[model samples]
Target chain A: MIGRLNHVAIAVPDLQAAAAQYQTTLGATVGPPQDEPDHGVTVVFIELPNTKIELLYPLGDDSPIRGFLDKNPSGGIHHMCFEVDDIIAARDHMKTQGARVLGTGEPKIGAHGKPVLFLHPKDFNGCLIELEQI
Target chain B: MIGRLNHVAIAVPDLQAAAAQYQTTLGATVGPPQDEPDHGVTVVFIELPNTKIELLYPLGDDSPIRGFLDKNPSGGIHHMCFEVDDIIAARDHMKTQGARVLGTGEPKIGAHGKPVLFLHPKDFNGCLIELEQI
Candidate 1:
């Protein structure tokens, strides 16, 4: 079952510039940055009052983040993540429901090194859903 | 600065069927139905732990929700909303940053009789953001 939302991820062309814009607009602070080499992206979390916002930027040409940036050049909202108790179970459950899983076949470490799995947006009516084990 | 995210609103063609599918998949309970005549949408909110998801269907051809549903026929994600302390201030602040505002000039009663305003998706990089004053 899905738990609470962990954060909403946004793909940006320039992480630092995007963070500065959000800080000025939303009155929030960005957390320390982390790099996920396997995903080929570096991300930072902006702690909001009730939910955190993640900013993602590509580290390489083939970066999945780069693809998202290319698709959404204006650098808007990316995906919404829900915290789950067990990622493996959630991934299986979603797959049973006919969802296409991205990333490793098994759950992999995400931006804060948390185990996470992504259900294809095509499965959820175009909304990219992320499940992360807390 | 902000209350919890009241709900993430998704524009769908069939609210009843969407609610049913979500219940079967997520084990959630959809709340009582409500209508916002001004916006021309009949909405049903599915209450989830820590957040609520709203399913919106249009009542009229000119319904703003209809526009969304038309643009996203595959029934994709619509908007993310955050509960705010002051809708007027938030709207003005966003406008100061050059965001175009939708809906009435002032916050008006929305689904469940709560005051709400929408920040243009164009301003936010294709992500429609709603602010509901709770």
Candidate 2:
């Protein structure tokens, strides 16, 4: 079950530019950018009062976000991550409810520095949902 | 400038079922549902710490979300609502940056009971962004 909105992930073509734009326009400072080699991407987090905004850009063309951008160039809303107390329990519950997990098994450290797993969009009517343990 | 995440909008085929499912699974109560004639849809809000989850369902077949669902039925994430301190200023800033406004004038009250306006996905690369004032 979703505990809270951990962060709203946005896919952008340029992470540094996006971060700077948000900072100048919204007056929101960003956290340090972090790279996740496994996901082949880098992320910068804009900390807000309640929820954080995550800006993502692919490291290369072969990256998933890059492909997503190619398909939907004006990268729309990417995925919504919900904080959960237990990733395993949440995955199992979603599975019982007929949701498909993206990876083989268990969540690994995600770009946001949390144990995260994705639910296939097919199960939730085309929305990719991320479950993270905070 | 963006305030904070007011809520994460999710498009679902069945609003009632989705609300019930969320309430039962997440142990979160539902706020009274509301409908916006302008948007041609009804919404149910599930409150959580810091952020709320909005379940949206079309009132009729000729709805924007409906068209979105037609293209991608798995009903992935919808729009992200960011509370802004001043809607007019924010809109102008986005416009100066070449973002297109979906609606003709200023923001009207949205389904979530706030002044909300949409920025066309074209500017942001394919993301329908909502700006709301709390």
Please tell me which predicted candidate would have the highest TM-score against the true structure: 2
In model 1, pairs of residues that clash are none
Q: How many pairs of residues in model 1 come into backbone collision?
A: 0
Q: Chain A TM-score for each candidate, in the given order?
A: 0.87, 0.89
Candidate 2 overall Cα lDDT vs. reference? 0.78
Error of 1 at B3 (Å): 4.3
Per model, the share of native interface contacts recovered reads 0.38, 0.58
lDDT of 1 by residue, A8-124 (tens): 787876677667656665445767678877788888887765677788888766787676777778776678888888888777776776668976668878766899888777656
Candidate achieving the largest lDDT:
2
Q: What's the DockQ for every one of the candidates?
A: 0.48, 0.57
In model 1, the Cα lDDT at residue A76 comes to 64
In angstroms, the error of model 2 at A31 is: 3.6
